[model samples]
Target chain A: MGPPTLHELFNPVLFYVLLTLGAVGVALASPRKGVSPQIIGGLVVGAAFGGVLVLLGIRGNEAGDLPNLYFYVFALIAILSGLRVITHPKPVYAAIYFILTILSSSAMYLLMQAEFMAFALIIIYAGAILITYLFVIMLATQAPSEEKVASLEGYDSTAREPLTATLAGFALLAVLTGMMAHGMSDLQDSRQVIRPSVHSLEAPILGVLPNKVIREFEQAAVFDHGIAEPTVEEVNDGFDANLRTMAFKIEDRERFDHGLETDTRFRSMLPETIHGDTVLVTLPAERGITNAEGVGFTLIAKHPMALEIAGIILLMAMLGAVVLARKQIELGEDEKAAQLRTLGQGFDDDVAHVGGGM
Target chain B: MITSLAHIAEPVTTVAPDIFGDVGVSLYHYLFVSATLFALGVIGFLTRRNMIVMFLCTEMMFQAAGLALIAFSKYHLNHSGEVFVIFVLTIAAAEAALALALVVLLFRRRETLNAEDWALLRG
Candidate 1:
């Protein structure tokens, strides 16, 4: 893909048309008005959805580009659900819609091959966090009766400042989408961005993996065994296996310094081949390293301090919540008087003295 | 084997740009998705009356940020963006806990979930 073109960034005409239609529909729908305009608004939003993708054109009509379909499908689900979350009269329904938004976004994460984040979104956001919202909604909502659906009754029925809010929200969306479309051409160059290779590793962690264990792999020959193991011949042997290891891109002072910075022991275990300034040491891929491993490696190895700080933040939240939720004990009249008496000392109120004494 | 070590220690050059020209999604697609998600969250946050729902919008915003970070990570082939997502997840979990507790406490006081009803909070 060359640099993005003007049309690829956006369709300005759709922005005005869709915004106008959406704002009008929301205005019509928000006031508990007739259903026709509301339905029309939904349809307009849906059309605008398709229009946004069309204007994007990155995922244009090409059978070859199926991944784009997943993006469109999931994004539509999230967008519609997000709109419903604000528009729905019932708080419980809004919670459910929020779940949809999360699930759809997780699907987007999966498309990007972020398996860890995708599943985390489901288990944490949809599972734990959303369940809490549902419970709160249930606890906070008045029980509906024969006259009304008590579960969803009251202030939730009508949005707060529906017309202005919807207009403002859509305006924000419009500005953002418009900016992404038009403002990003210069920054959106199609440079040949490659996936990070093994050479990117600053740590000799791969170097320290037991040579005996390393020898088991078929592609072990290319591995510069930090010991005096022979470099694999560039013969058809490795070709048959089709398995490759990440080889060092550079072997120099900078790489060694990085190893030392991470850990002296880790740096010390470096094979002579690695420390000797040769870059072709191929680190064998661990058994369970999907793309997520890089993320974990960064947390555990590169940015261990961040992991610890996250734990601290969670601990603090737990403490704060517990403190906030604790019951407030009531004071007896005598106890209250005693408290007031102590306060009187500061003001030096002789007549207001507690226990009727000076 | 020892003789080949010198060759290996230097550069094992990658193929030219055209050599590995595999077509895939661009960085912009992910960015677009993330931006939309965030905007939806912002709209929901502004427009929703339910306190819990508003926080839900905030969580959605966090999700949007995570998506964008992961995509940028993929774009640069770097792991920092992905690792930052771990922190984002942590903060979201923390926010949810504290925010919900506060919501419950507020609801107990006001007996209503409407944002407008809690107007006299400071006095």
Candidate 2:
């Protein structure tokens, strides 16, 4: 009824679903023969990757260790590489650069303890995509003639302006820079206090215990661990008096029974209740500590559908890439020969022209 | 000489003031690194005519972003930023795949993969 709890938001299943969606988005968006699709795919993938982490409860105060930092670094690299791939003129280099980006990103995932994701990235991107790209390049055609190279050089140097792309790239860079700067500044100002507090020292030790057990320990310390049994004021005072008398006897042992009167005041200050004794304590129900681990356990164990969806999406992408990359010859032998003849003629003419000029 | 070396080692061993506390690498350092990387990427993007070099420059930009994200994540001790990084890797992989494929196709048709030769798509 109220806003959904943090447990609901931290659902691993939800994270998987988001990841799957991102994969599908990439598959749909990647260009069949151009850089636009690849760029879009990269953006979608980056968003999905980031979204999963956010949904999986890795962000904010919940993040742990340096692995998370590496994960972020990888994602940022992926996004920038994707942008470069689409915008860059030379396609082959973009491809190689993108691969490097992916590999580094995978390393980041490995750092984050996402072993499965990291391995998958290496296998799919590096092993399959890169090899396939190389094969395609080798099978495609010969290198351009010197004339063609010269023309290309001319075009690059004196081509029509890519005004829109330049403006867009600059704008995006500015926005990203601004956001990064702002986030860094905010974090710097909201400095985390590094005081040598009990919590800081004992957190590693306490983290080993189950959340519920730890909560119980805290509650027991307050109420059941030699505290005055909660009751009406008059009833509690009598219990307190008995606890004080017991403490006085313990203190008297150290002073040969001579300091009993002197330590009576100190003894009275001791808690009234004994261990394992049930007291009529009426603790506020709302004051109970929420078990963080309990919430995480329930979310992961409860939702299996999200995981299945993510798997299916990955499979779809793999299948789609296979289909797209399947070798199919459209031209007949005669047509191929004719094309080769034309290429040969073009080559000869260029050679003859160079000879004549010399 | 040994005593002098020991004196030097004392400062080395306790370089960071415990009183000031140890936060690994300040925000300013992170910002400076990020800025330098970004500037490098921008210059490469602007000056380089080779498409591969341009992509490399873009990768540099990404590296900058990654550095920034990592710096922030470490400071915040948050895993979300890292998780976001994983998604970035996945996308980059896909982009590389398709971009390479296109490059091969372009070369087959035009016999060149140079940026200047890609006037077919312009007008």
Highest-scoring model, DockQ: 1
* After superposition, candidate 1 runs with Cα above 4 Å error: A19-38, A58-66, A142-152, A186-200, A203-242, A248-288, A327-358, B1-26, B121-123
TM-score of each: 0.71, 0.39
lDDT (Cα, tens digit) per residue for candidate 1, span B1-91? 2232222221211211111112223455566667766766776676667788888888878888888887766545456777788788889
Q: lDDT tens string, model 2, A215-312?
A: 43343322212212235776655633222111111222333223322445324333344333332222222221122222222223333344355456
> Each predicted complex: what DockQ?
0.29, 0.06
CAPRI docking class of candidate 2? incorrect
List the candidate 2 regions with Cα displacement exceeding 4 Å.
A1-185, A189-358, B1-25, B42-53, B121-123
Clashing pairs in 1: A144-A150, A278-B9, A279-B9
What CAPRI-style quality would you assign to candidate 1? acceptable
